[model samples]
Target: MNYTLHQLHIFVKITQTKSITKASEELHLTQPAVSIQLKNFQDQFEIPLTEVIGRQLYVTDFGREIAIAAEKILAEVHAINYKTQAYKGQLSGKLKLSVVSTGKYVIPYFLSDFLKKHQSIELILDVTNKTKVIESMEKNEVDFAFVSVLPEKLQVEGIELMPNKLYLIGSEKIDNNLNESPNSILEELPIIYREEGSGTRYTMEKFISLHQLNVKKKMELTSNEAVKQAVVAGLGYSIMPLIGIKNELLNGELVIIPVKGFPLSSIWNLIWLKNKGFSPVATAFLAHVKQEKTKIINEKFGWYLDYIAK
Candidate 1:
């Protein structure tokens, strides 16, 4: 019963992807190499770790448990390395953040300099939907959560980073003569929407309900990028954050339609639960954000402010 760390790593990846090919691709190893290692690892145990049914691969229940244990082992190894870095007088620990999908555009700029300054710190940034981000915060799984809309049910403290502006956008190919009235445009074009549990979806629904707009429901997509592509293809119009569509807007691939009470706005916030204790790495990241947010916004997102002003 001797197994190497490399075998454990391969097995963990196989369980995660449930496909030998995918595991190989993710690990940057050849398929034959992954298969050989997996076979070697499987031989060390009597019980089967994975099974193939038809063309699909599945991790057995035992494999799932082993993968979880493997994850814990890997994390411990990372911690040991971090400890050595700390003995060298470097700030070394994991800084984990769960950010809503659209925040990908904003959070990276905020993190870039901080991560550069603390080269020894390990950063784990998960870009996911708002529901998952909030759930991670509630479970105390991450050090911070970045969202445009603050959760009403969570007792959390947050710092406002910048304003997020949402506007109804369409392909630039849309006719200029179409009625600019909010209800008219909404009723005229099929409206692409983000899926339920998304922060953007919540805001869009609220706007629709408030205006009593009868929007033609064209389709629902799960991500901002998907919605953007749908709109760019002239599939429909969607209310999207200006931050995510800067490139499309600049390239004239998309256009903001003027409507009454347009550009619904919210503040982007980096939040954590009130009772949660922060690690040293998390504290340093928070401080870096507080000191650098203004500068980062002015330098990286000034165009967004100017666009909103017009």
Candidate 2:
């Protein structure tokens, strides 16, 4: 019944990664050393913990239970360690955050000052599609998540940061004035769309449905950059956030199509699970964002503000 925390940690990592080699790599231990520890751990329990099949490691049912218990123990240990540092008035830890793809353009700008101010904090930012970001958030894989569309079912604590404005963009070579009406554009122009599960695509669909607009979708692209490029090549038009294409808009490479009920607006939000506790670093970043969002947006996103105003 006596097992070291180090042994338990290695066991948990092995179970999660399903590879002793990977666990060793992550733990910065030699492969043979990890194998010895794992063997010793199994001997203490006198229970087969893992089975090898097709050259891949798989944890048994008993191993799964032990792994879950080990994870909880490790989490408590980590909390104690963090509390010790906090008591010493030291704020030093890694902050893990995930954001929707479009957030890459906006989140960094908001985080820059905070990162510079808190030199002790290490930031791990995962920029991915909306679906993956939401999945990560729901699984509590990240400390914070930035999204334009809020998940209705998750019990979350969130703050609205800024407006995300979506506009129909086309190449400057085309006459944007001609397709001011949805019906005219529906019949005459081809529309480029983002891939499924995109926040932009979701918002665009809602807008289309609300207005009873049926447009011809010419292509479905995986990324905002791809959609923008397709539109710039005169292949079709796309609805994208203004934040992502400020430079193109300013340079006149793309023109916003003046369509009715245009510039579909949504809110940017920072969220975390309601029951999850926030570390000091997370709390600090939350405060920084809450205080600086408006000022930063007005300063860095002045073009968007001005455009929306007009």
Candidate 3:
């Protein structure tokens, strides 16, 4: 009948993940510690809150209700903390964010200034594929998420930060040929694909489908860096976001092959669940993004902006 809010927080995490092991990892606690806490929590109540069935954690109906209550309590606690900090004209809290993999290139520019302004704030950033990012958003796991493609199914509020332009990139060896015959580049050079579930891969697929172009598949890489490396080695050409290849293009390590329909445009958005409570940190970040987006983009991605506009 009596348990610590700490234990309830752990219980909520366990219920969300359906695994004590995962909950432990997320909570940055060892398995034994998490287990001890869970046992101590259950000892407080006469009924078992969760049962281990088939090597998996299953929350009882009572456990679900307890988790819901814990969520509300934790949210209220966070709001109170945020309000206190805001009233003091200070920004101090952990900013939890999940970003799509490619956003690794873009989010830092936005975060750097914010961090400089509020040195007291801590950041926890998770870089993952769009699917996992969306799952985190739906579960209310992060304060905000940065992504180019927004999920149609999730109820979220967001503002577009900047245009995400995808370009056909290849080695300099084919520069002359690519310039002469842009369409033939697909037939001549094998196309390197990003692995499944990538937002980049999804956009490439859409572009391919729209053009009805049959591209030669040579290799599929799991990361944007791997794909860029493969393309630089002259293994194949890849359709990649310009943001990811800025340094390479600037240093002439990779060449952007001009194509008639290329530089496919998408928008990067800073998004959060519409129903989730907005903390002071989250609100500040949202306002910062909107207010400084143009300046940030112009500074960090001016070349991309110029290229896409051409």
Candidate 4:
């Protein structure tokens, strides 16, 4: 019943992706290499870990159970490696963060300096949607979650990092008629949207409903980038975080529609459960944010301050 850590890691990835080919690509191994390892690992156990049904791969019930255990083992191994680094007097551990898709632009700026200072600290930043980010926080899978809007159901403590301003943006090729009333523009143009569970979608819907603006929903995309691309391609307009579209705006690919009661704002917050305990790395990161948020914003987001001033 002896298995190497490599086998456990490969098996865990297989269970996650449910495809040997996908697992190989993720792990940077050849398909034959992954297959050989999978066969070797499977040979060590009597019960089947994975099964193939037609062309699709599926993890069996036992495989799911084993994957959970394998994840735990892998986590411990990571902890051990980090602990070894700590013994050398470096503040080292895994700093796991789940950030909403648009937050990818924001969080990395906040992290850049902190990571440079602490070279041994391992950063696992999961850039995902709001629903998945909240799910990770609920499952205690991350040290922190970066979001513009806080979840009503999760009682969490957070530090505000910066302002997240959302604007109704359209392709620059579209008519820039500032004379039109907000409601008239909304009613006339089709609107693209982030999928239902996105924070941007929530804020957009709230703004629409609060203003009671009659609008047409043209399409629903899952990510901020996708929505931005759609808007840039003149598919439709969308309420998007200003941070996510800076380059496009600068290059004249996209333009913000100046609507009354527009640029809906929220604070980008790094949040954790109210009662969650932090590891040394997480604690250091929190402290770093508290001390450097203002400086980071001033350096990285001065344009936003200028935009707000106007």
Candidate 5:
């Protein structure tokens, strides 16, 4: 006859996530069902407990106060549940993770292997670009994300992932008048670029500016594959992770441009909200990633053959 525990659980998720859709995904409920519950909860209140500001929903002062109380309530309930489950000695849950595009290449292999080790868990993944990944993290859209850029004012925690070296690659198909000289490489080839807000793009621009080179951007793309494909098609030259283009480099579809200091590298990092409590599954998954990072990098990509015949 009173509010159900399910409602409180869903409502608490809503407060933490600040979006109906994110809460629905985390709680495995339909959007309409979440909306109905939200409306019911709001109707019970004397004043609206939240507001929308610039596409993000915020808990009002009163709502914030109540949500803090709700957090304590939920924490206690979960602690009890966790202790009971620990007594049973079972680990079964879903890990919800989102990642940036470049991470799409690296994170999955690491995650899959972790899943193999922890057979009782499931990995729910959403692979997106850096901008969306950061935005979603700020809004509590995902439990965790892998990123290269850590923005200011985002309430998040970041742990450094392994550093991947960057390289400037030119299509063997394009630079017919090729030279091993870095200056010549910069002087001759058109620069292909990644999309705006990309960490790779930022790094590339900084390096280019630092080196004081004239840029002739010929093409731009969002996907790493597109950038590589553009380079391979002889459309232009580009900079990217050396890890991602190993095959192309080995096969001679792409050539590592011999610019004195053309390519630059940076570290990637793991991200999660500072404010949100980790679900049991998410916690286990984070631990797994931390443990497996070295193995992931060291695992020789043997099939990593230069597939293209030059």
Candidate 6:
């Protein structure tokens, strides 16, 4: 459709979300408003943009070309915004960031301190699952990502951010039943697992495989929060990043197992597309990460730093 940059943005967002309803919610627009815009666009175009089939909306092949063009056009707009602001000697733009589910356990804390220090710069965070995190980064929807056990195939250049340990955690409901600590529960406890593509799940499974265990699973969960809740409900035990349970463990809402083959740790990565250029704000954020990396770790998790302390 022959449309302005703003309409192209709405069009691209709707295409990505695949539902007018979802796109409306994300854009803070009324569903009818999006509908009206789509109608207006169709009237101006040489061909139809979307077709409805069985309660689902599909962009036509012709519409796909328009969507792709819109994406590139929006990206150029964002690029110009970056250039315009950088010309003004200000790192004052929103840094759109996406992080995997587990990464939130620690990122918010770090990001808060960084944002407080850089008051003019904004951090727009999109906390999502691992697969979405990688896809969003690859699509240039996000400026930076902190992910765990990221696939090596991602066309992104990543730096090792930090190493994180996994632990067996369960709800406080099982605290009394825990005959031993999580580190010691690997022998016979039924374990709640993350879904198949989960990096955390893969890492945990690899640890069990390394120890040569039978690899029995109790249940599979999709979210870390759900796993925590399930363990709290005594539905089953689950292995999660140490940071995920730190607060709960301290609050006595969940307990760590003293199982023998635990403390399964893996490296966390800070990744960005190798060919993508960073905005001034993104560049500054990365610089902060590099400069304060050590002190941040020392203050954030003294227990983790103990590994290096020794």
Scored against the true structure, residue 309 in model 4 reaches a CA lDDT of 63
Candidate 4 regions exceeding 4 Å error are 1-3, 45-47, 60-69, 173-180
Query: Which regions of candidate 5 are displaced past 4 Å?
Result: 1-89, 173-184, 300-310
Give one clash count per candidate, in the order shown.
0, 0, 1, 0, 1, 15
Model 5 Cα shift for residue 215 (angstroms):
0.8
98-120: candidate 4 lDDT, tens digit per residue: 99998888889989999999999
Ranking by TM-score: 4, 1, 6, 2, 3, 5
Taking the tens digit of each residue's C-alpha lDDT, what string does model 2 give over 1-310? 7889999999999998999899999899999999999998998887789999999999999999999999999889877876776677877677999999999988898889998877667688998888988899889889999999998788888889888999878886445464366766655778898889889999999988877877788999999999988887888888899888888888887988777777889999989999898877988888998899889988988887887888
> Where in model 1 is the C-alpha error above 4 Å?
21-31, 53-69, 173-181
For candidate 4, the 10 contiguous residues with the lowest summed lDDT are 172-181
The estimated TM-scores of all candidates read: 0.90, 0.73, 0.72, 0.91, 0.64, 0.77
Candidate 6, residues 78-121, lDDT tens digits: the string is 76876676677755678888888888876775677778866667
**Which lDDT tens digits does candidate 5 get at residues 1-310?**
3555677777789888999899999999999999898777777778888888898888788887767877787778766766665567866566777777777766777677667766666567787777777787777767888876676678778678666567778776434333354556665668889999777887888877776777788978988889999888888888887768877777888877545554465677888888689877788878877887766656743332222111
Deviation in Å, model 5, residue 87 alpha carbon? 9.6
RMSD of each: 2.5, 4.9, 4.6, 2.3, 6.9, 4.3
Question: Candidate 5 versus the native: TM-score?
Answer: 0.64
lDDT of 3 at 162: 83
Alpha-carbon shift of residue 88 in model 6 (angstroms): 1.9
| Model number with the top TM-score | 4
- Clash pairs, candidate 3, are 1-44
Model 1: which ten-residue window has the lowest total lDDT? 172-181
- State the displacement of the C-alpha of residue 171, model 1, in Å, after optimal TM-score superposition: 1.4
Instruction: Give the lowest summed-lDDT range of ten residues in model 2.
Output: 172-181
